[model samples]
Target: MAASSTATIGSYELTSRAIYEPPAAAVREGSRILDETRRLGSRYGEDYSDGGVESVAAQNASAELAESWKYPRQNVFRTGAAFWSLLTSGANDAAYGALIPYLEEYYNLSYIIVSLVFLSPFVGYILAAVLNNTLHRRIGQRGIGITCGICHILAYIIIAVHPPYPVLVLAYCLAGFGNGISDAAWNAWIGNLDRANETLGFLHAFYGVGGVISPLIATNMIAKADLPWYTFYYVMIGLATIELVSCTWAFWPNGPEVYRQTMDASNEDNQGMKEALFKLPFARVTWLCAAFLLCYVGVEVSVCGWIVQFMIRVRKAENYPAGMTSMGFWLGLAVGRAVLGFVTPLLGVKVAVSVKILARLLEGSLAAFGGSGAAILPFAVGAIAQAKGVKTLQPIILAFLTALLGLWLCLPRIGRKQD
Candidate 1:
């Protein structure tokens, strides 16, 4: 009886040990499954078809493994997933930002609260940047994305119910954190593509789609029907759900394996990524890229956030009209992204990504800087009219308007005629 009890305890310990590390037989089986891939990767690299029998055998073995693993056509799936995810992201932004004022009014929002809401997301970005690779390495891209989706689900639901000011602040923080994680993950996933710039352009074009359409839905309901602004969160809930499901479905079962394979193939010759980055001109170029994106986003988001008020107060427009003005700006963004996507491949991905980023910085900076000047310029124009004892500023307004109109109407025609 004592010997039987001893055997039972021994069996229980073996089972627990297998749960953590598996038996050596199972480990060997896993290793053998990837042995051909390692051999191929180590010997002839990712593309080793030099008409050699050994390489041919390795290739066939790797192909069979890929087929059994359910990731036969790797390149096609991820790009499509990224495009849809970005579209959802863009939609969420429009729905939420369009009703900021109503949100403020309902929550009795203070400037400090607003500052916290904006700041919390950056904190999340920092967290994701630090932790993303490690977590992705452990749990796969889909795992990271699933957590991001859960954050969104919690965040929007909290906002939809019009939670207390402190709770709302917490919700926005959650929203920002979720956004940061997904954004980093998507960028990492898509950045590795051969046609990175072209795919990125298409991805952002969907962002423009959301930016344009989401606002229309929000404004029509809020400005026209006077529906409670919190109602917009339902639209976001729907969008976030779609994003979550699409990403989950696309990356399931084999995403981590594929990532490992891709990373191994890509990194074979470059020493290490860190070593290469610290080497000369590449480091400098990386810093410049980072700086440009920082300034570009600051200017872009600021303009998008405030332009509605500018139109409403300065142009004396009603809420619906002011909202439409924002939609027009977003529509232009969408159109530009779609058109520029074609241009990306022609320029080469590296040059194209840099130049496009610079162009956006230039475009957004000029608009913001010029808009600020325009805001002050009109008052100065009015002051001159007042000083001259002109009863009406209409003549001055008309003269400026006529010159602007002439510029708008004639420049394109002259350019076409020159062509």
Candidate 2:
């Protein structure tokens, strides 16, 4: 069969690259092609034959499959770039930890208004589930990403200029929308890429690194400078500008059809966007992700956000300065994640979880009983003792509990491949 006598399947245009050969060569090449096609079909079930194809169909299918293979690589590249960009942008801090303090000090925001700022992102996330596909179709992933990048930069600038609280709130809402949309699109794009599990882990690790670094950067600047709260916003603005430029350059000449294909297949269960996002097997996974995120952020923020104050006020650990203590928490988190990445695959996620749980228990017990000197332990722990010098243990105990919760939450699917 000629390569041109091919058919389209999903986004792929199939063609046969088989050459005329002797009997033995033909048999070898035929078997190889069959194996390759099977593998391709398994990976992208939407793009290939449900049943065995005839000679003509097989030729067409082979060409389409070949075309389809190119996308996974492109997706992996784009996803990795997006992940890195997201971290360097500094938007995550504004949405997560710094928002409360910024609002309180700069804007004198009321409690209700502050709560709204914090909650708005989740609403944006949910809304993204509805809007993601449409936006992808209308503007393409690259375009949406570029647009999101611009929005993030604008939001940072708005906050840096010290807009009115209402305007700031609107700016954050816009930032939330950008974050939600970009997150959904990039997640879906990366999920479809080759070696997706490893890529996902790497992407998230970068996110973790960003989370760890942002607070340190903000706190360090504040400690050194005599400027108002706006200095941090300036830093964020600078970071967001870099992200915008990177995204724009990376995704030039954007259009929907250039990257991913539209999914036109019909489904009984996925009758509407909400049903598709919130229904069935995915609903549980989504809820689990949300719960894990909540716990992870809470523990992470508590330690990094409060540890310095806790150290200065409660522990009175003069040896370790405030900046160093916060750095320690982030360093611990980075070390933990790095260790987990190496150890999880070797020992398996279940074993890793068990090990972390046991380690935390031991650490917590020691901190609770061993007193102030327990701060010397490799892991941070938080414990409150009745004695004068024992309060230092509280942070240590908190760190242990935080690690335990994270391990427990991640245990179920630690080693399992995603569907």
Q: Please report the candidate that would top TM-score against the real structure.
A: 1
How many angstroms is residue 180 displaced in model 1 relative to the true structure, after the best TM-score fit?
2.0
Q: Against the true structure, candidate 1 has what lDDT?
A: 0.58
Q: Write the per-residue lDDT of candidate 1 for residues 1-419, one digit (tens) a residue.
A: 89999999999999986776555665566566446445333332332232113466675565455321123464466566666666765665555446655665777654334434444445555555556556666777878668777778788899899877778767866776666666666655554443445666777788788788887988988988889888888888887787778778777764566656665675642353343246555445444444434444434443444455456545777878778877887788888987886775664434544443323222222222222222232333334533552223345545555554544443221222332
- The TM-score of predicted model 1 comes to 0.64
Instruction: State candidate 2's TM-score.
Output: 0.59
Candidate 2 per-residue lDDT over residues 79-98, each given as its tens digit: 55677665653235322343
Local distance difference test, each candidate = 0.58, 0.50
| Residue 262 local lDDT, model 2 | 35
Error of 1 at 46 (Å): 16
